[model samples]
Target: MTALAATSTPSQDLPSLIERAASMLSGAKTAAEVLEAREVAGLAYDVAKRAARLQRAKSAHDDLVAAAHRAQAHALEIEARAKRRLADEYDAAQARGEVAGHGGGRNFKVANGNVETTTADLGLRRDQIHEARQLRDAEAVDPGIVRRTLDERLEHGEEPSRAALRKMVVDAAMRGMRPQRRASRRNPLYVAPTPEQAAWRHVTGVFRAFAEWASDENLALARKGMREAGDTPFHDLDARAIAQGSAAFTTIKEWFDAR
Candidate 1:
């Protein structure tokens, strides 16, 4: 049995081989037939075990891909926050006039033993701040290239440098910013009046008709009917008022119609 197992052809497609083996097992009758069925069943079992291992490996690879994307997104968020903080600090320093070294007009002792007053170059920090702001805006508008680059670096087990990330952001900006798609506008639900309340419109039309054609005594009777039905004399015709007035309207209309 060991010799036969060792000599059996390696299965290229495990699932197909397993199905064939199952068919063999289902039709076994004699001892020789049963032995052949058992051998096929054993092969199927081995193939199933191999398939499980392959599935696990595929799952692990998928998980790694997901982790890479998450890491990229988190890193970009951190970078954006740091740039914002730096810009804020730079603004505060400028406001306090503490960035004097950035502006011109300072005297320094030269290596040649001569005291020289030279204009200080104060715009370096400001330029850096401007570049940071531009990169941040570009990232906000279209982060696809930056995200892809960072994810690739993470997949390769390399830490992406700040310079590389900034370059990617700039490259994306050069490629033209992609405007974000507007979210689909949904009309808000129109809450219909309750059935009882909605019936009040018919009731009010009847009241208006009675005011024009009916006698004062009949109109007084209608008002009394409305009060009895829980409607205020000067109801605002809101949901509750409509609900209360529905019964009064029905009673007045029926009396007038009968007359």
Candidate 2:
């Protein structure tokens, strides 16, 4: 990460940060430089998102919010490009016998030459390489899906949330469809939801829906059914069962706490 990426506080200088990262990635002479540029781009995206949220909360001008979102979209493009670079470099490294891993991939064991840095030496994970390739291929197939998703949200008065995009990707993957690609546009940038992002949307969606369904009255009736015999087994929410605390409350609380 560079000094630009170290920006912990929200600043309007996200454009500069993104520009620097793009320059670094384009001019990168080494894999490390690509990684650094990606890191900065990631930071730029995060900071711009926060700024957009802050502006919305303060009821600032709509233009300000839209500009921040545009910054985020651009930053994502740079990050995707970096991923492509890293993927290509990893392939080249494998050919040069510069990548050492536990299992053979693309090639059999080339006698370990202690002469140069390996994939492990540079702290590159096999998973990252695969994910980078996925992003690159996704762009080839779908064109400007990454930026278009964000810009669409801005135009539609949505929050421009990354979670929403991840959810779309997961859903698309489930249905064996490419994610939200239009034939009219094309661009080099792309993103595919990681397992972590997919899992997040899954867990949060489950919790949200469950919380609404498991209201006090509903739980109370279910409790009655599980408890005493023909005691109507149903009642309205007087807040009685919830206020006094019951087996159903304890069970739900425990499950929620575990989560």
Candidate 3:
């Protein structure tokens, strides 16, 4: 459905190409299609990255420039799957002794880990492969983290750079020395949330379920009657529960009023 599936070059119009990248990802219905979508997205990210570098010189409005950076961030996020797939394929090849591990990283079959097909033979540098491995490892922990951090930086009016992203990843890794995660958290990268971010996240997370529960049909169901165990509805409103909920709401109202 797209011409860029086989090519790396993207259209000159950054916004239009961003749309295409998004469309490719959404339209993908098969594994092969998904891989192709990653390719297109990677191309979009590359194009947007370059275009954004000149946005200041072009004197674009702040919003427009930020939007472009965000598009780049989104595209890079989509391309993460491609990074994992590439690294996995390389690792499998290394396991099979078809290629050496980049920079002598790992290889089960080959002792020296040197093989016939070099990364150079495949037209990739050691550093590129190493970066791919890093992306793969990080994504395995928390998908879309790179894009999220990039967008976070842009939202704060900071220049988004590879160094910044690397620092974030490294910082998160360093925080690994913290105590083990609670059962609820299962800490992915150990990146701590700011106080404000944590508060907002807690509010949204709680309200999302509360909103669904307060929907019209649910509210009616809650008031209808006690549901039978086997032959009736699963959930029935209890007087004690309702009282607790009312008390909770009042407490929240008071807290907000105090604020």
List candidate 3 segments past 4 Å from native: 1-12, 19-43, 102-118, 177-259
CA RMSD of all predictions:
33.4, 22.0, 16.0
Candidate 2, pairs of clashing residues: none
Q: Write the per-residue lDDT of candidate 1 for residues 1-259, one digit (tens) a residue.
A: 5322543447334334433443444454322333344455445444444443564567756434333333333334334434543344444544555444453233322223353323232123446566655654564454334556665765575544456677776676678663333432453454545646545654554557546767888778867866653442112222343576677767766878999
TM-score of each: 0.26, 0.54, 0.49
Better of 1 and 3 by TM-score: 3
Find the number of clashing residue pairs for candidate 2.
Answer: 0
Cα lDDT, all candidates: 0.47, 0.64, 0.59
Q: Write the per-residue lDDT of candidate 3 for residues 60-130, one digit (tens) a residue.
A: 88755765676676566666655556566666767776565444433323223354334443344567566
Candidate 2, residue 64: how far the Cα is off, in Å: 2.1
Model 1 RMSD, rounded to 1 decimal? 33.4
Candidates arranged by TM-score, highest first? 2, 3, 1
Question: How far is 26's C-alpha from truth in model 2 (Å)?
Answer: 1.5
Question: Can you give the lDDT of residue 151 in candidate 1?
Answer: 59
Worst 10 contiguous positions by lDDT, candidate 2? 229-238
- The all-Cα superposition gives candidate 3 an RMSD in Å to the true structure of 16.0
CA shift at 77, candidate 3, in angstroms? 1.7
Q: Best TM-score goes to which candidate?
A: 2
